[model samples]
Target: LSKQTKDPRKKVRMLALAHFFEGKSRYQIAEYLKVSRTSVNKWVKDYLDYGLEGLEELPRSGRPCKLDDAQLKQLKAYVLDSIDRTEGGRLTLEDIQQYISESFHIEYELSAVHRLLKRQNFSWISSRSI
Candidate 1:
């Protein structure tokens, strides 16, 4: 089960339990797993308290996106259209940043703009000018 799991953290938890069941000490498991003894102890405790379900990751609430789906779609269209509208058929991050600020009335850091474009499937190479 540990070897098959794609999630590295879960794999560690499963392996820790497996090692414990095999009569390995928590210190031994920690050294073998390259994890802290505290972490190994916690994993063992969680398993004893809640079974296999305790090893699973809990859902986390991350920061929400500034733009919703519809707004993102509109932004993508506008970016595509900018190439046709520009003199050299080139669109830069500054141009997109300005457009986003003017059209959406929302200010985003240049890095955040880059991340947003990436999330929308716009590659860095494609979004750049010659």
Candidate 2:
């Protein structure tokens, strides 16, 4: 972190602090480096309170998935199946939505069905296979 840091003073500060922790006498370090002992002590305390990762940081709560594993499995079954006899030989996004809405009572958009199907390796396919 000190090597990559833009500020040369920060590297010097960190190095002096690490030397103190490794049993170098503060007065000896200060005399050799020509700096005050107080600055070395402060940097040591700051590094101990917060690890290096905490010094420069980001915050993220990540995106929530649309479907869980079980819903995903059921959705995959619907998508890859040759026919939905439950809705007749014909199937559409509306049929998928209605089935989900009726059974689980979870209303979702029709396009969402297309996305879910695609995520499960289904595609807009030739019906000659049907």
Give per-model TM-scores. Answer: 0.58, 0.41
Question: Tens-digit lDDT track for model 2 on 45-128?
Answer: 666788653233245586454567887777667655736454536567787778777766677788876776676677755342
- List the RMSD of every prediction in angstroms: 4.6, 14.8
- TM-score of structure candidate 1: 0.58
Lowest lDDT 10-mer window, candidate 2?
51-60
| Minimal lDDT window, size 10, model 1 | 121-130
Error of 1 at 34 (Å): 1.2
Question: How does model 2 fare in lDDT?
Answer: 0.67
Q: Candidate 2: which pairs clash?
A: none
Winning candidate number (TM-score):
1
Q: Candidate 1 on 91-118: residue-level lDDT in tens?
A: 7788788988898898888999999999
- lDDT by candidate, in order shown: 0.86, 0.67
